[model samples]
Target: MSTWLLPESLADILPAEARRIEELRRSLLDLYRTYGFELVAPPLIEYLDSLLSGTGGDLNLRTCKLVDQLSGRTVGVRADMTPQVSRIDAHLLNRAGVTRLCYCGSVLHARPAGLLSDRELLQIGAEIFGHAGFEADIEIIELALASVRRAGVAQARLDLNHPGVPRAIVDSDAALAGASEEVYDLLSTKDVPGLRALQARYPGLRPETTEALTALASLYGGTETIARARRVLPALPALHRALDDLQALVAALPGHEFSVDLADMGSGYGYHSGVVFSIYAQGWHDALVRGGRYDGVGKAFGRARPATGFSLDLRKLSGGLPPAGKAQAIRAPWGADADLVAALRRLRDEGEIVIQMLPGQPQRLDEFTVDRELVLDDGTWKVRAI
Candidate 1:
C-alpha cells in the first residue's frame, strides 16, 4: 500500500490555531449581532440546482458534487455561503419585505485558477435581503468595511466596482447576450488585447460599446484614476450611476482608504445587480472580504427581494494576523474535593486554556501544556506563572 499523504491544497487546523479562529469568529459574530443581524447556519449540502441557482462561472466550477444514494439526485457541497443564504432567503425564510441575516461556517469548493489556498475554507458573512435602492447598497458596503476594521485589519483598502459596465454593453446588443460571460472575465483581468479581438469578431457592435469596453480595460488605480476613467466614458449613464454610487460610499467612509476599480471586477454571479467590492490588507495579495448587492437574485427563487452582503476568508486573515498569544504551560493543583472540580469547570467555561493534575502528581506550571495555570489552595483559586 502506498502512503503518500493528503492533498497538497488541503490542511488541518491545529488546536491553537483552531482556538484562535473560533475566538475571532465569536468576536465578529457578537459585533454583527449589535448591528441587528440575526445569525443563521444553512446546511452544508443542498440540491445542486438550489446552490447553483444564481451563482455562475468560476463559482460553479469550484463546487464539489455528489449523487444522493437515497434520492437518486445530485447534491453539491456548498462552495460559497452567499448563494446558499440567498436560497434560504428565497425558499425558507421568505421574510417578505426585508431581512438581515449573518452566517459563519466552513465552505468546500474546488480551487480556482491562480488561487493558492485549500478547497475548504471557513467564511463569515451576512446577507441583507429586500432593500433595492442605493441607500441599501451603501449600508451594506459600510457594514462590510466596519466588519473588516473590527477584525483588526489595520490599513485595509476597499476596492469597489460595478458589473453594470459590462452588463450595459451586453444588454445594449442582442448578439452580446450569450457572450457576456466571456467578455466579463476578459475585462476583469484587463485583457485588453483579447477584448479587442472580441470587438473585431463582432464589428457590427456600436462604437460606443467598444469605447466602454476599452475604458473598462484601463480603469484600475486610486481616486484620481476613477476621475480619469470618468473622462473615458463620459456619456455612459450606467457608468456614471455606478461612479456616483461609489462616490457616496467613499464619502461615507471618510478617512478610510477607498478606491474605485472601474474594471469589470465583480464575480459574474447572476444575482449581483449593482456595486461590488473587495477588501485587502497591506501584505496580502488577495482580498480578505468580498461582497456586493444582488437585488434580483431572490426573485429567481420566487421572492423579489433586494440583497447585499460579504464574506470574510477566515483562513486568509488568520495567516496574515500576528500570533494570537504567547505560548506558555498551564498548571492546576490536584485535590480530591468537589470544590476543585467546580473551579476547574468554571475556568474551562471562561475559555481559559487549563490542565488538571493527576492524583499524586505535583502541580508545576511548566509541566502542563497550556497558556495559563490555576492553583486551588485553602478554598481560593490563584493563577500561577510557569
Candidate 2:
C-alpha cells in the first residue's frame, strides 16, 4: 500500500475546506459565547470507561479503543464529546446553578455513519446542565437553528421525537423488553415487515404490540403526527407522558417547521430521557444537527443534572455551504529595511493578509487573492491597488 494512502472514510482537508471550517468554528463558538456558554476543550482521548460514561452501547461501537502505554488500561478515542463534558460538569466544576458549556473538536468514528460519510468529524455543540425545564430544550433547539442560519443555511426543517414514547411501548411487552436493541433497529429503519415478524419470531407476542410498532413507523409527518399517536397507540401512562412532552415542545416553538417521528429511538449515545430533535436542511443528505434532553447523563459521575444540547459536524456543514471566497491579500516586495518592516508589521497588525515576495520567486497562492501591492512610494512604503 502507498504510504500516503489514507483510511477509507478519512481524508485530508484541503486549504479551502479547512478555511471554511475554521471560519464556522469561530462564528458558532462566538454565538455560544453570546448565550453565556463557556467554551471547553476536552482531551482527545481518555480511559475507556470515563470517556463512555453515561453514553451507552451505541458509542462503544463507534469509539476506537487501544491499550494505553502508561497504565496499560483500555483507552478510547472519543467519538463524542458530550459524555466527557458531562464528566467535567459532574466532577470538576461541581456547580450548583445552571452551567452552559460548549466545545469543538475532532472525533474519530470507527466506521462511517453512512455510505458517503467520513470517519473523522469536527464535532461542535453546546450543553446546558442543571435545568430540566422545557425552556432549556427550547434554547438548545433555537441555538441549533441559529447556528445553521448564521452559516447562511436556508429552509432548514426541525424534526422532534421523544425516546420515551417508543421506549414506553417497547418496555410494555416482555418479548420486546429484552430485545430492545433489535427492535430499535427495526423501528429506526421503519422496517415494518421486520416488526410484524417479531410475533412469529417470538410466540405469544401480543397483537397490540405488533400493531403499535407498525403504526409508529407511519407516525412521522407534520405536527399532526403527535395527535394521531395519542388516538392510535395504546394508553400506557409512559406513552401518554411522552406524547405530552412532545406537545409541550411543539407548543413552545411556534412558526417553525416540525415533524414528529415516534419510531426513532435516538441513534446517538442512547442516554436521551426526554425530548429529542434533529435539524434537516435542503443541502445535506441527512440531519445536520442532533441533540436532546439527557437529564441523567451526569448521574454516573455522582451528580445528576438536567441537560439539553445539539451538535453538528463542521466538516459536513462546510461541505453543504457555497464555496468560500478567496481571502483578500496585499503583495509586498522582500526587504529588510526598517521602514519596510514597520509598514509590513502595521498592515499585518491591522488584520491585513500581506504576502512578502522573494526575488525571482513565483507567486504561489490558492486560498488568497493579492489585489494590492506594497511599494516604496518616494521613500515611504505605501499600499496601492494593483
Q: How close to the true structure is residue 188 of candidate 1, measured as C-alpha lDDT? A: 80
Q: Which of the numbered candidates is closest to the native, going by highest TM-score?
A: 2
List, residue by residue over 268-378, the lDDT tens digit for candidate 2. Answer: 678889999999899899899999999888988999999989899999999999888899999999989999999999999999999998899797799999999999889
Q: What's the distance in Å from true for residue 288, model 2?
A: 0.6
Model 1 C-alpha lDDT per residue in residues 166-273, reported as the tens digit of each score: 676667776576787788888888888887777678867766676678777888878776677668774567767767767766666667676777774655355577
Minimum summed lDDT over a 10-residue window in model 1 is located at 363-372
Error of 1 at 374 (Å): 5.4
Worst lDDT 10-window in candidate 2? 262-271
Q: TM-score of every model? A: 0.86, 0.98
Positional deviation of 287 in candidate 2, in angstroms?
0.6
- Candidate 2's TM-score reads 0.98
